[model samples]
Target: MDQKTILVAFGGASPEHEVSVITSHQAIAALQESNYSITPLYLTKNGRWLTGETLLDLKNFEDLKKLEDSCTPCTFGQNEFGQPVLLEQKTGFFSKPKTTPIFAVIDGFHGSKGENGAFQGACEMFNIPCTGSGVMGSAIGMDKVMAKTICRANEIPVAESVDFFEPDWVDHQSTLITKIESLEYPVIVKPVHLGSSIGVEVVMNQESLIRAVEAAFKYDDHLLVETVITPLMEINCSVLGSSRAQRTSVCERPIGKEELLSFQDKYLNDAEAKGMASADREIPAKIPDELTKAIQETSVKVFKLLSCSGLARLDFLVNEETHQFYFNEINTIPGSFSFYLWKESGISFTDLLLELIDIAVEDQNQKARRIQSYDTNLLSQKAVKGIKGLKSKK
Candidate 1:
């Protein structure tokens, strides 16, 4: 039996570039002991797709320019048998290019085109099995406003807030501020399309809110300001499998130094390794069993509501005193694939990756089973004659 090649795709033109790299490395490490052959599909910060065995090492990333120079440029294309292949483009005029059959793709991206549905759409176009949410789900998951709106319409609890574009913030600062202030002071401001808390801030007054919004606009054109869950308790839970059949992992109460978990707190501090898995958290979240069950149930609901697949980590903000929780955001390609949560749920990292790959294969098979095209030639003589007068009539 031939070992299947899993393309672990990661990195992107995203603010969370480093975080994505860490995630890809962690996944590669886990898959090393497996029977599958791993191929590193590393997308550079400027958006070039490269692949090579060197990219599989975490240390090479210390100097990104050198690392990018070392890898081979590659892309997805079909082989002679119409099977998907990772085609490594030739570097020299006389050099023959190489091709590697891609069995499936493990999405290790965090933000931007990598996680915002673009990369997933590429995989769909190639008919390659891709792990994680589909195009629509990934796009919605990346946009904070869209996710909240969908959740609200589905009767899922979410915080009330106002969202605006950069032009609105610049042209009508006072008006936007008024709308945001309506959410009240000490609200949390976040970049609408970013993750890893890249441009998230908690503001106490109008002045600080203005400053935070100005700063966040640097990362994204759109911004969301919502009422902060004071006496905040951040609970996270991971969900696995496709929308049709999924299960939730154990909940985690991420312990942060401040009300909001800063990027440094989550990834930077003590992050010589262990991407998101490095974050301080109480696994199985010491909350009551009933609350945990409710959270788990809600997590699964939102997972299906967003049409998420493979795996996702849903974060919730709970009002500690009231014991009320509201959906915050969903990480479709969550850092480290949220395997830590699954670990607490009794699934090892290797098992989790294998399950995700299996789900992707199953999804692709299901799609293949459908009637994708008809046998009719629309431009045939009879069909052309039938439509000849239609255009003129219309």
Candidate 2:
């Protein structure tokens, strides 16, 4: 059978770069056995795109710099027929670069420009099929403040939050602090655009809040401070498909050692580095059946609300005592694609990935069916002739 090349793109210029590598390798391992031809598009931490057979091995990731040196630098280019292809850059004087046609792009990236819609927009520009949300969904999902705002508008339960930018804090630090404190002490401060709990902190007083905010600013200029739910149980559910149809996996309650799950708690605990799969979580979350159902329903709701597609894991903050769950955030490109959660629903990691690819292909086919460009010549010669009569604002 003729094989379509599926490009697994990962490792971005983000704080979660290492986790992204692990996620990509896991995906590569699974997709290798599929009918498609798997190609690795490794994005270096410095924002360079490279690809090679060596990138398929997880062990090669131990020395990122050395690994990068062995790969061929590549970028998205169009074929003579205007189809997107992974074009390798010129290496040596006599080197003949090869182009690999990209049938679909598996978004293995975790954060920053990768998860925040920059990469998705690039795929859109090239008319490439990308697994995960489109530009709007990815952008909104990356912003905690925006996600919460949408939840709040939709009457979805969410913790009371006060969000501000660096300049806002600089201008009115005391006022912002006062507003945060009003939500009461023991509040959680988080970098608005970060994940893996990198710049998240729970503080009981003004001093700790100040320090947390200052530190979080390093990860993101925008910050969100919200009341911390005491006896909080973090429940996460993975959603599949787009607005046309949707499904949610069994709920999983993450077991974090600290006040909240940290980057170390999520990825570094395992000697093998299994990404989010190795992290401790109670599958089918031992919560009440009704609560599980509620979370499952909410997960799909949030997924549709944010315009997410392909796959996403929605995390909810549940009050252990009251069992009142609040929409926390959505991971558009969840680690390991949250295959572990789907596995509980009778879906294997490989099957989960295959389904995601199927969804992406269907979405692309539907997109192609739409009327893309109007035939009207808005920029005809007559329009260009009038440009000289217009005055400059300056």
> Per-residue lDDT for 205-233 in model 2, tens only?
98998899999999999999999987889
Cα lDDT computed for each candidate against the true fold: 0.92, 0.91
Model 2 CA deviation exceeding 4 Å by range: 92-96, 391-394
Candidate 1 at residue 207, lDDT?
A: 87
lDDT digits (tens) for residues 225-246 of candidate 1: 9998888999999999895698
Give the lowest summed-lDDT range of ten residues in model 1: 264-273
- The TM-score leader among the candidates is 2
**Clashing residue pairs, backbone N/CA/C < 3 A, model 1:** none
